[model samples]
Target: MSLPNDASEDRMQMMTKTERFSKLFDELERCREDEQMQKMEEMNGLIDEMNEEELKSIFTIELFDKIHQIIEEKTLPLENALVLLKHVGYYRELKIIYLESFDYSLLRERMKEMIIDENEKKEEINEKILTDLCECYALLGEDDIFGEVLSIIVPCLLKVALKKDETEEAQKEVEMALLALGNIGYWVEKESYGNEIKEIIKYHQEHQNLTRLAYQSAWEFLIKRFHNYESLEEVFVNDLHFAREARREIEELKRDVDWKRKEETGKEAKELLIFRKWIYNIDNYFTSCKLWNEEVEKLLSSFVQMIREFRDNSKKVSNWCFFSITNAAENRNVKIDDLLKSGAVDAFSEEMKQSTLEDKIVYDCLYFFLNVSRRLNEKKDDEKKEAKRKSIKRKMFEWIEEGYEDVMTSFHAILPDLAEKSKFLQLSKYSSDYLWSL
Candidate 1:
């Protein structure tokens, strides 16, 4: 018979039995297409007689034999061989067989040598192979295998990607690592695996790009894992703020070129202004010197006048009027009456009376008032404390009455029984302890 072309000859030489069987099926179909029905029938009959398991066994054996032949001939391309094996589902099986056939300690030592090599090429080669392995296991519904592969590869990828001398190639690898981590975060329930993911994010926070991605991941992860959130710890928030600011700057840059520039610029300016207020908390702290304070007051008064002019001309109420009152109370440590008398809180209470109590801005004003009140309360003298004690007692009584009314409304259906039991019911000792502690 004539020898096949070089490419086909090479492919045949490297073909495992599994690949041979797959090729046979391909050939038989090609034959049928060419009107070679008799030969196709014969092949189909043979294929039909064997079930999937039997075909798998025959394929595995043939692949093992073919692998040995290619090894002996030294003609096989490792990547091609692996790709063909995976196509036929023999690759992973062969890996298990090969590892089991080895003295694991020797295999491990060799792997260690490969990894510890100072040559970047060798490290890249090893990591690519590892990443491929992980992809295979992940695709095959082997989570434990995938997790194990990642646990090994992530640290190595991080090391390679973080190195000062790493090329753009390494940065691509870092991006891939983030993508892989994101996948892991998706597949695993946040509650079960969030801490481990958070630690990985914490480590990546050293890199600017990685820090932004990490916090973005954590934001989604936290909402998924926990229903309620309070303050992010100061250290975490401060570090994450860098990433947040970077993202904001990037969005601003993009907006500058886009059609939404004006609108987005305004939004960015507003956000940054709000963040400035949050960061400096000037209204809360009031630490500015005389000249600075005078400048701020002048600027604020100008803005207030502009808003009032707009409101009066339009005959619409300004929502921000109460803000001046709250700011005065917080910064000057003065009562609402004192601020109103000084004309610092002009038309503010009037505007507030027209607004709904449930408005978010109103709640913000109330919270600011509460903060101011608590601080003022902290500075109370003995005589003031005595006066406040009666006010506190009256408030406590009102709270108890409200609580009782709510409970009665909720269980109104059981009124007669509830009434009979109410007299006999005493607060449990544990309930008293818990209430006292609160």
Candidate 2:
């Protein structure tokens, strides 16, 4: 009698759990049919109530297939479909299902229909859905599909981004759109869409009401898409403007470097640090590109002068200046004669004498010297090439003559370790051979 009663209680408990699960599914169905946020929230609550084990048991592939079928049938609103997708673990479960059964045409049509439908409801914009759709298309890795989606959505995003009298909510919408476009822009062919995207971003940047976030996103998109100097000329020009400002600030800070070095905790020091970062970023930009014009030459010259003045004050600034010189040398933009004439070689030698010199600084120095050697080797006149090589070798020895032993000791200690890293292996070999010969 006791065993029968216990079995009866166990069956009742199972029935109660099943009943609760059934009610939750019914609520989900209602939410799917009527795209109501409140119902969606309640559904989320129900999903949250279940532990991981219970969730795994209840939200199985069979139910997921049913939701996918509902999405296919177009009976449920997309938002509601997405909500159901989220409940069933959208990224974890749905992504696997879609990727395994990758249907390009079906997904493309659905995306097109959704965008067209959303455009029809202009006042009631659903940018989140659209952004998510862009992300989804990006993940699909279908260039044509991504391009098609971008073509449709970018204009709409631009419209929002360029809207007059934008409220805060509208601004947020524009930001979302720009971010999505940027993400999509990274994968798509730049030639097809870069100009239009740049134009939209330029408008956002020029607008007084727009936030810096939008401008920055647009700026990054432009930089990433267009690699040519002509296309990036505007950014270079902006960098020049900032560089000018920094130069002026650095001049002001130069007067106080002596006072500030002692304390290194005042407004002057702070301002100098900020200016140094600006200079580093500016120099890095020039280093990254093949912008070897007269303007860049002038910039390099200014950097040399800055190095000479600031060498005693800031190691970071000095190191960046050396890096810029090294990069210019490597690119064959700054000739060895000009670099030596600018006192850059002397400055590099001085910096190397410091015990606190980083491995990167040593590498840059070796890279610069290697580039100089290569340039000399490339000369048509053998006599002139040998003469120039001997001159550079003599200059290197002269610079390190005071602490040659110390510099060689440091090199011996660091070179073996640097040789183990593939990037610096060649430099390590050349420097080690050069030092031993010297």
Candidate 3:
């Protein structure tokens, strides 16, 4: 006798999720070519409905082992497995299962084969498949994995980063590849790939070659590789920013603000804590990079522009921007020549002459001036280096002479603050003296 409808529905609801998912895997294993997309859609539907606990419970070692077997047998498409893996890739437990189980070398070989043909093809789905694989490798990249990805993925990312066209697929390709490179870029061999990496870093500086996310990721890779130092103070200027916002937000919540605005404020505060740290750290790291002249100049241009538009982080941004540039200027053969070539002298002269100057900004500006000024005094300079240095100093004087009175008056306006701060920065005192002489 068949059970009544209510009883049958109750039985279906009572079935264990593992049993249900097991059957779903069975279907995935035998899905026909025409049904693969629909199957993925269905799988996503199921995945969406699963709670965190249920999802976590479902992705066991056994499940990954089964998926691994399917991949080895070519039952499920590699990309499909990757799509499934990505859903739970954030869990450390599951990530290890993937790392240990997948025959990565074979997987890479297969992907390379497909992509070779895929280059000439315009299939978005193929691009998506390649993209998904890249994410999996990026998410799973540990020691050896990071090295492998750095080698194979860097060239592809650079090629896409240089695409002049703005097709959606092309843009997505660039974004994904940039994000991958950011994740695994520490393994990059700076000698072999440094020039191309520089191209990507500077590619979008003058004009927009990358979207905002891609631009941030390109710098992310650069900062990650050169993160050789940390702030002497454990707390950053942004930490204070975060704290003030948090306190203000909490007070607003006590008085009751709109839920959306309150939550957004909280989110912004947290993000500020991290992303802003990244901003100031650029100064710390780039000082060590000394990528030199045009490369360094272009990056500084990009970085300063980003912070120039920062929301509520102005004081720190102003100080950090020049501090980092000043450090970057310290490297061998680096005189920030390209920046001067772009007429930084006139621009800075005008800035210093602003109606009211913050002594702090003036202090920071002094450091940048000090850095470029040192190049003019290098004792052992080759004629090429000396010529380069002299040319920069000549440009500064030209700007100064053109507006000598205004420039001198601007220097006088800050002389008191420079004297006050000189106890801490006697070197900058010398720069002040040098500027006065000019």
Per-candidate TM equals 0.26, 0.48, 0.42
- Look at candidate 1 and tell me the lDDT of residue 5: 88
lDDT of candidate 3 over 101-166, digit per residue (tens): 233334444544454445446554365555566555564444444444445556665666667567
Worst 10 residues of 2 by lDDT: 92-101
By TM-score rank, best first, the candidates go 2, 3, 1
The lDDT for every candidate, in the order shown, is: 0.37, 0.54, 0.52
Higher-TM-score candidate of 1 and 2: 2
lDDT (C-alpha) at residue 331 in model 2: 61
Worst 10 residues of 3 by lDDT: 232-241
The local lDDT score (0 to 100) that residue 307 gets in candidate 2 is 71
Over 1-438, each residue of candidate 2 has an lDDT whose tens digit, in order, gives 569889865765566343555555555545535545555555555554444455556555455456556567765566665654434332222112223222333544565667666656777967677655544433333233444456666665556565555788877666555544543445445456555555665554456555434544454445544443345545545443323433444555556555455345222233343344345445545555544454555556777887776667666666778887887777654556666656666666666677676777777776666676566555355787777766765665555456644564567666656655636336635444435132
Reference-based TM-score, model 3: 0.42
Which residue ranges in model 2 land beyond 4 Å of their true spot?
A: 1-128, 132-146, 149-160, 163-186, 197-213, 228-288, 294-328, 334-348, 380-413, 422-425, 432-438
lDDT of 2: 0.54
Order the candidates by lDDT, highest first: 2, 3, 1
Model 2, position 143: C-alpha lDDT score: 39
Better of 2 and 3 by TM-score: 2
What value of lDDT does candidate 1 attain over all alpha carbons?
0.37
